[model samples]
Target: MTDDRFLYDPDTAVDPLGDAEATRAAGRSSKHNYAKVGSGRPSSLLYNYGPGAIMDLPHFTVMSTGLDDWERMWRKRVDSPPEIHAPRLREVVAKLLRSRNVRLRPHPNQPRKTGLSREGNDLGVPARVFPQWMRCTGCDLLAPLSHFGYTNTHPYRPDQARFEHERCPGRSGSRSGKNASRAAVPARYLLACVDGHLDEFPYDQWVHHWSPCPKVEFPVLRMVDRTAGKGASAVIHCATCGARRPMNEAQGDAGRSKLPRCRGRHPHLDAFELNGCGDATRLMLVGASNLWFPMTQSIIVMPRSANEETSDLAARIRVAFASKPHRLEKYEATGDLEGLRDALDGKLDGPVDEEAIPDDQLAKALGEALTSGESDEDLAKWRADWDPVDLLVPEWNYLLTDPLGLGHEDEASGLTLSHRDRAPGLRKEIVRVLAVERLRKVNALVGFTRIDDVDRVADLSQRMVPLARAARPAWTVATEDRGEGIFLQLDEPAVAAWEAQVEQDQLWLAHRAAHRRNFESRTSDTAGPVDAEDRLRPPRYWLVHTLAHVLIREMALECGYSAASLSERLYAWPGSDGRPPAAGLLICTTAPDSDGTLGGLVQLSEPERLHRVVSSALYRAGRCSSDPVCGMRTPQDTEDFLHGAACHCCAMASETSCERANRFLDRRFLIDLPGSGIGFFGLPG
Candidate 1:
């Protein structure tokens, strides 16, 4: 166990937001880059980052502390804080909550604080910092920072007084200057059970087993690297017990049996699950990218707030009522707003002032925002025009077919749209360019997983943590992003014909079976069984997904955007239960810091430019830099069994940009080869 004092350095203050000195010196507030990887994560990993997901930073790993505890980290509080204290990302939040059956409520209104450092730089918020124990690289002794000398270069010597190494007398047998020459860094090895319990590597017990120490109570332990492989080849030694063991088998399946049973620990909350759990603890490296996987869900914004025809009117109503608190009461009373006011009020620092605006004037504004002198028949016709049976299809239909839907009548959205002409040979497959002027994507960190494959887990509650200390939470912290995009709805006839092909269906099944077997093997037992519904998806879905990725890669090159800055949301589910087939891909720009409407993405939607982008993307996909070997490999031959005809140099997007965790992808179905006759594009004219 580490010294509890290192958990929080009370004397050592930090200001996470920015510092006064640094702000003044730089003539501006110090910049803070939270999560440099941008917010949108692959949908498969969304379950990993709910209320208390464990997030790894550069110097330390942090469990996203509960929302109620956020103020504890700041040194000072600002007055009249916004709903989240951070930006509210209006369009993003509105879109996500549109269909979820949950109301769109503003985040907590608390001021987040920071402090300045001596050298005029911003420091992290002055929150508690739990020391997950440190490893003395020189002696390989595992202990708290207090165990080593206070100097920059110091070895582990338990007898040394904290911050005072001059009076230590244990250096007699040590070589001159060699003793205390190297500093100990934090131990990277960690252990986690399926029960969401985390604990430090059990070094002491591993060396001695369950037997009592036959020697001194304070046995000296040293980690020695006697082999060429630094981490894998290193061996641990007990100077007191004379027992030694290697750390090479601490991660894989064979190592799990050798490792001790889990003790059930939650080092972040400073709490433990004391009821006892028998689940085998999995070994994890702190810096590994797979250690934390965030589960996220998003929705597209429709003109109608709730139902069909009313979407356009609802959007207009929201635009009118924004920034005008006085009109809220009237809007609420008239049923135009009703439940909306309460959700909007949370965004304010305090309760809405009753006297801000008169009820009659507010009514007049609301009325004017709608159709002037409109009769009940007109309203009835508008509502009748919407297909209430299918919730998402109507919204998608409006985006694809409604010309006035992307109209420039409203300037608040910062949206712009254009109708692009189809290129030769591509016209029969891709229908039209539904250019999006502006788009908002709000991703909520729902839960997280560790040392397990995402597909194996079915229940979210098993992986996620509550926002509060209680067993359940009513709220969680989320970030919303605003951006621009272009939607390309695949031709229904072309998609139907491609889906009907016998070879395409067989090809997809072969990959699916391989994927299922590989998935079962890699998934941890604790993750439980995979959901039956999530396992199988239509073949058209893969074709559209591959194209989405290819388009994003091409767009990034032509439109001056980094591939990492772009994200894709597929709407390609086959029609069922009297609904129309929804096959389209929306490739959009995402940035946590900006409004997201940079005009570069929408500009590429022009007919002439789009032709080049599609042609170039298809040409590149027909042949990869890692061809033959990459193209010839079957799903059974691949490690994950989830990819076919897709490699790092071709189909794979950055982790942040992909939605399916880079699974269920095959570029072979898109273009043709000598033996592969089922290419959807039909071999380039």
Candidate 2:
């Protein structure tokens, strides 16, 4: 019988490698010992001795002469590919790929020839035909068989390479897979300034490509000092004292030659030392923020210097009026500055009391409200301040000095208390989410680039951050790894912190609203009123505060807050603690802002955003409130607004006073302090 196993029929129409061909390697037959048959088997003796027997032999097997000869003839190195060491060889090739960036691709169909796919011209070897060709996945560049460095495991043969990831080291960097380029551009993706406010890198400002964490949408701010790594940061020597200082306040070595904090507690350098440095090495100067922004209101407060008589930052600003308070007397008395100052400071002789009346002033003020003629009358009566302090007195009695931080609101804590604590503690997390989302919206409005464009995202985010800061600069954000990412967080803690800043911003807005509304002209001026000049009119600081309100609200809406909410949050009277408390009655909303200056293309009108902002402030924490004047109504009025959210109507006695009234600070005394500089940090430069 003829055995066809191990057959190598080259030119035949019938292929030996056909699907129906049975594998003879695994069968047990006399033909399986074809390589050993010559030792003793009849098959080997008969097959070799008789020429007729040759036709009966297996198709591809030949008999061996002896036992050793059988092994030798069947296992020649030239006869078989190395399959036993396949696993170990694969490992070696993998290691080589890691070390030398080599990859393999066999010629298609295991042929011996192929061409390269790389950009540069590289010739490939032509054999029978390549089973595969080589390709450099890194940089998407490829090379032919001869170019790659061959090693013990990775058959340096060109057709044996595999696919690899394309490495992109960016423009002007390395041709290798790991080269990062040197960049002189602004090394930040997102910037948070010293004020705890956030800004981002604009296209014009960002030179390096932004590569933020794919997982973290809002990247935090970080910075890598080149000097810190290369050398012990550029040493700054003082000219006169010759004092050597390192820069940046994050590290203590920095001095305040240019930076005030670096200068010293007082941060003042004598001319001799200034002459020594001569700007050769400008000492680290304390600034508005790590990131630059012009005209931001978030103040960088200085530490109050001791051993000085006038270093108090909280100095009573002398109520200095660059212009006269817009009182009726200012127009009538030809600017009686002396009389006006005396009346405002409570210098009139008569007891500060409301006059006996037919309620004539209210009637006269109301009658004037209809025609816009009384706007001037309304303005006058509004300014006739029995005592601006009186309106503030009720507020002081209820402020919570000790604040319970976010989340852990226990009994007596600001978060759990009823009235003493309040103000929507504008959480950092809240602000960040809103800022990023709003940036996308603004980008949509302007139509420059998509929300995902790293450059555009950075720019829009920065421009819209003032909305979160609400007129104050928050933090400065820089990038880590030079310019690969962003670092945005609150800058330095204000002497008052975010809570106080919010309160002050809101307070000034209210005070100014009252002031602006006071200009109405009424038919008759009430007599015996603490003199005509002592009106509750807005002052310069108040107007400045109102201006801040306008800007913040505008930005917040551009971010997508409802107009009503925006106005309400902005309107809410923040308590000592930054969250809104029971002072709902104190929330003030007078008139909307003046028309937009940005032409017809960009009209900033958002009633809902304003309302939400104000309402959020009102609901921070309070037992209850009933201020019909502002139309702010709280659902609960018995518990402290900053702490617990209890229903006072159902739980507490109706006649109970709010909890905050009992814990009020001696604000009256604080306000009446004789001179300036009472702040933790003294007045600014």
Candidate 3:
């Protein structure tokens, strides 16, 4: 279903064709695909990032598709991703949504499609987006994409050709001889400050800064990459004024000296300078790895409070009255408890406890709750109170206690966990839970950081970066998903024994020293006291973490899900008297908007399969494709500091699948290494 609110240039027609075929046929591609959705994205392109993210897009097409040109293109709202049905996730997600004052929509009936599709959109779901800047590759002119001409071209059908900005340098160059021959690409460089305001690079001001030549009206600029010297020696020159400057001087500390102050531009939302961010803009290339680092925290859903009953009732009521918000409104206004309950009972296919949540209370709660994201006031409040990393205490409590409460039950409410029979060393060192049912995991995109770790920032306000260009947006797009997993909790005695080792403490200290050095290098601030408790994980953490990676790799080979689809949540902490020590890892598979249970993950957890999977993973960790060199690497300030005997070939998993940002992993701790006796699973004498 197409979002009616999506902005479309009436003059342009967007086709559903995939990007590759259109590019191959030289057929007009969809302009919406650039920053919207589609399989047409180039391999080098990376989107689906939150605010503070920088990406490069080919300038020319803007969006390639059916209608080539437009008299004018207008801006519209970004459509939301399809919501996944997750009644179980509603309680926590609803609380979060409520805290932000976002409206809760009824769960979607069908599973939200995953990945971009060939049909010219993100699996047919397009985000409503309009980027503010575009750069002309031919002339190196940086301007908004809206300033350029529009065209829809199918190589063989020239009769449908059209143009908007006739005088644009990019268009002139592309059409100089005959038909338009070029498309503008997104400017590869953008600037952002610590305050989270992003803007185009001050290219014009930089080149013209040191030159004595008077600024000429309508100056022509060109980017020249010099091959003779260092890569940074590339230059930007103004033909009209004969002004020139090396690109390198405009970047880093050197660029800070030469460039103009930050203009407080937020091109995405087209908003700028309220009080004005006075910080000098730093030079950044689009697609820099640091441009966007998602600050995300996840929880393993476990049956927690009696509140679940109320939450389950709420979800049922929501789905029953989703299509009839007016009825819900009536119930809310009148507080007509009995009538509403009766109406709900008539429509709902399953039972809902009216007693758990009385009609009046439900109405009052729903009334107070913001379920629709259409109101401006609701949005403003949302941005003001946005919480990126919510406290996971409740979720953690649920995960730790609830699964065991189920006893040997194979499943409960579409969720289950079954203990496996003890293997030789399994029961002695690890508590057993072979398979888990409906392991629901919800991940939401809160904010992003550039060249800094938002996770380290203790202040909540500092982590809330602007995703919108203009004033703080009332709401931002986020995703909710569900999945199943395999659970393994280490035996407390085993973990204590492992931590007791003097050599283990030394090894952990070395990794910790490296971590401190790395942290200091990233920020000037001293490590927090909590760093010891949280960041400086015990030796058991490395062992469990590495084992998780090995198993993820082994499971990926045959588990229906790809390695990327599976994720790990490690629970490890040092023990102290009277306090419960936690040590376990939940390796599971999740999807954007599905029930997240295909049974493959749980199947691996079966007693017979668990033995084989764990054994194979440990065996593989004993060796490496880049052996000796990889296995012998030491943790130091300069290199391989965060790792030990762990590399992509052995212990590393995709960034998306790892909770620790792929750190605190060491294969040496999981298996016996040559000249190293630290393996948790005993090594030969």
Candidate number with greatest lDDT = 1
Residue-by-residue lDDT tens digits, candidate 2, 186-266: 121222222122222221111112233333433222222344333224332222222333333223334222222111110
lDDT of 2: 0.22
TM-score of each: 0.71, 0.16, 0.71
lDDT at position 272, candidate 2: 15
Q: How many residue pairs in model 3 have overlapping backbones? A: 29
Cα RMSD (Å) per model?
Answer: 10.0, 37.7, 8.5
Ranking by TM-score: 3, 1, 2
Q: How does each model score on lDDT?
A: 0.56, 0.22, 0.55
Tens-digit lDDT track for model 3 on 1-685? 1122223333333333335446757876454333232222111121333333433333221211110110011112123423323344443334433322222222112222453322322222222223344545445555555566755444333234332334445423354533334445554556766555566665666677744447665566666653533435557777777778877776667667766666665443334556666776677665556655655434554553455544455555665665577887787777777777677654542333555555555765555432553355654455345432233334434445544543344232334555556566443466656566665554444345555566554333343454432132222333445667887877778767866873445666678778777665554132233343344556877878888899899998867889987888776666445335677878888765445557787777766577777777788888888999998877765653678789999889997788777788887777679967777776521
Report the error of model 3 at residue 394, Å: 5.3
What are the runs in model 1 whose C-alpha is more than 4 Å off? 1-68, 74-81, 84-131, 148-182, 226-232, 241-243, 248-255, 300-398, 401-416, 421-426, 502-505, 527-533, 625-640
Collision count for each candidate, in order:
28, 138, 29
TM-score of 3: 0.71
**Which sections of candidate 2 miss by over 4 Å?**
1-232, 236-685
